[model samples]
Target: MEFDASHSSSSLGARVVLIPLEGKVIRYAFKLEFQNTNNTAEYEALLLGLVEVKKLHIKMLKVKGDAELIVKQVRGLFAIKNERLRHYRNHVWDKIEAFNSFSIEAVLREFNSKADSLVVYAALLVPHPDFTTNTYRVELVYRLSIPDNFESWQVLENDK
Candidate 1:
């Protein structure tokens, strides 16, 4: 699943999508953007997917993403220092706690290419060229490498 949140001509919008390798492309929600940071947008994507999973009564998820920061944050390694991100992190943690079982993992961008493509396509709908954007969480899946789980800060190996 993925999401791209931003504004188009002074409107608050968000898009929430989830893609399962085994099933259909689930579009949970979509909007232009709201008052949100990229970190918040990323958390929304994960939370939206979790919402669907809850509705479906499914448990035990191996959620994959390309964002090292988000993956690390979710894994309890990186601290959410920003006041803005703290809220999102807390929101995501709440959704995670609702689940029976789940694990967030970093994956190669190649594995998340389709969702990244969705972000680019979503960008085209906005009317304003200079609108504040928050596509980070979804598109960033293409930048992560194999992770090192050796230590507490080892959510990723060679993260740039």
Candidate 2:
């Protein structure tokens, strides 16, 4: 699975490409209507991909993304100091533990170009008249995958 994300003053978006060990590749992109940082958007991308993988009953997964910070934090190479980031990391780890086997790596942006472009396209919200594929999909998400606060939204902060 490959994932990437983009964030702007107006929106947050993410894309995921699921490459089965043997089968067709699946591509997914989503535009987030809520407020979130680029790091959270990266986590959202992975979370969305993991949900789809779980639905397909896939036991083993190798995830690749261009978000170096997120990848290193997930691998325990970087310390998560912020409360919100710690929450996101813990949530990601919980999902990873459910798999029989899981690995995540950080790749160069060029290597993750497909997902990166998909995210940009989704964020732009321009219709692709040439799009005629059943394997690719874009969706609009009205909420965050992980809430700003575990207990309540009242505690939300400007983590960015």
Candidate with top TM-score is: 2
RMSD of 1: 12.1
Error of 1 at 143 (Å): 28
lDDT of each: 0.54, 0.83
* Candidate topping lDDT: 2
What's each prediction's TM-score? 0.61, 0.89
Candidate 2 TM-score, true structure as reference? 0.89
lDDT of 2 at 32: 80
lDDT of 2 by residue, 33-144 (tens): 8778888888888888888888888899999999999999999999988777878887789788889999999999999977877888777765434344686888888877
- Candidate 2 regions exceeding 4 Å error are 128-130, 152-160
lDDT of 2 at 96: 87
Evaluated against the true structure, the overall lDDT of model 1 is: 0.54
